[model samples]
Target: MHRQFADLRARFLARKYRTERGHEFACYGFSRRLGTMVRAIDVVFEKLPPELDTIPDRDTVVDATLMIQAFVLNAFGCLDNLAWIWVCEKPVLNARGKELGPLEVGLGPKRRDVRASFSKEFVAYLEKRQDWVDKHLKGFRDSLAHRIPLYIPPYIVSPRLSKSTTSSKKPVEMPSESLTWGSTTSCRPSSADWASGGLG
Candidate 1:
């Protein structure tokens, strides 16, 4: 696992950083690498997808947050779950028949079992984080969905119209056959037109 992480880190640095000094690290040290990952995750959360933005089913959100959190925290082997119960100090305890109180001890014979039970506080924390992530993701998605494409209008030139009404010098003479019977234009269509039926 350590070797795999090392290989992945090396590959990430090589691809993203691309520098002459290989030992200086692209972004930061290993811990800083985790920080960088968290920051990236933060951006991912901030730009929530439109589909996942709305308030989702509680169970579904819980499941998704657990999966995402586990991956981000590198909590493989189910150790993260255990850590959530024991390390983060979040667990429910039942001491009905026992002398100790709820916080005194956990369920099962061993302390491990006692630590893994669900706790209200921890569940609340997870819910809050999920809410935050959901809001940002939704906003990001909305922005993307409503974004418009850019376009540049083509240049156009229109013929200028003449405003003068007075004749300049003598009007040019027109051929006798060029003028129609009741029209001043030469190209006049008569009743023998091809568009009689109209073009649909």
Candidate 2:
């Protein structure tokens, strides 16, 4: 990975991007939230079965589904943090014309100052993108958070199944099979590995 952040920070934008009392280094928040989303995605990928016919392990599948939800939440968090960067940079205002207080902060319609600070094209682009994110990421995360969690069926109906069987409410039963060691175990990194601050 590019590890030149310190070098870059020392060279450029350090003085220019200094935060005011209410402002912050929102880019750091964006990066941290993005990192969280990436880790969630990595775990979700790990839980994914190598084949459609792989053993349907309930625990692993459930963990993977939850991680997927986590990824969506964190992904939206990335956008929220990014929105703060623009708001802080332009120093937006409220109706009273006071520097906008930290209130609802996200890539949503509420952050009107953030939208107004940008060019028309950029604002339009953000609106469309926010719509997409709201539909895809926010809806899923909201459902998982407030309504219902994702449900991974106990069985994965193989795509190789006959059309008739796949069309039916019940998939044709398959024989049970042994799985690899990784399949039977949790996908989480060990505490020691996490303590090392490395991708063990």
Candidate 3:
């Protein structure tokens, strides 16, 4: 994985330094393509079933891993599609000034200034968009991929369910007669003791 990343970085940097004469970075290189696949694999592995206590044996682990890998692949493909949408979606700028040409041809100091402004706004927009996407996808992924049936603790469980489990169990009761009251019954109530006045 490290080697693949190194190769990808090298390829990307090579393209970065190359003269863009409309042919430098035309095709996706072998390393870059494999890097994408590796990314998908990583996502899948990360979502593997966490609660393996219920798993019967070693064979089940292997089977679950394969299933998780498939779900991860599907998730990766969805994310890739989203990335493609972002890349392909151009900002619709309605400008009254002189129209600029393509990026390679028209990019200069002034163009760069415009790009910087656009980049700041575009980055914020993309981040917000991705956040919205994540909000929607997290629940779906939790159910379809990362979800594991967790046991409810007895203490944290509802009273009815707990009562049903232990039918013979009895709840502790307090005696009202044990509570202390005033020796004299005919005394004026204090103003401070107006709210929830307990027996003296």
In model 1, the worst 10-residue window by lDDT is: 149-158
Give residue 81's lDDT in candidate 2 (0 to 100): 60
Local distance difference test, per candidate?
0.34, 0.56, 0.37
Give the true-structure RMSD of model 2.
10.9
lDDT tens digits, residues 10-128, model 3?
65445532223212222243334445556646654454434322323445445444554444334434443323322223322225433323331111122332334346666566456
CA shift at 76, candidate 3, in angstroms? Answer: 2.8
Clashes of each: 1, 0, 0
Better of 1 and 3 by TM-score: 3
Best by lDDT: 2
TM per model? Answer: 0.18, 0.64, 0.23
How do the candidates rank by TM-score, highest first? Answer: 2, 3, 1
lDDT of 2 by residue, 1-200 (tens): 12453344343334456455213444356555555666777777678745554655688878887787777666656666666666666666666777655564445656666566778888787766765665566655555555566555555333445465657897566544422223221233323322210001
Q: Cα miss at 127, model 3 (Å)?
A: 5.2
Q: Write the per-residue lDDT of candidate 1 for residues 48-124, one digit (tens) a residue.
A: 33344233345543443443433333312122222322422332334553323323342221333343454767655
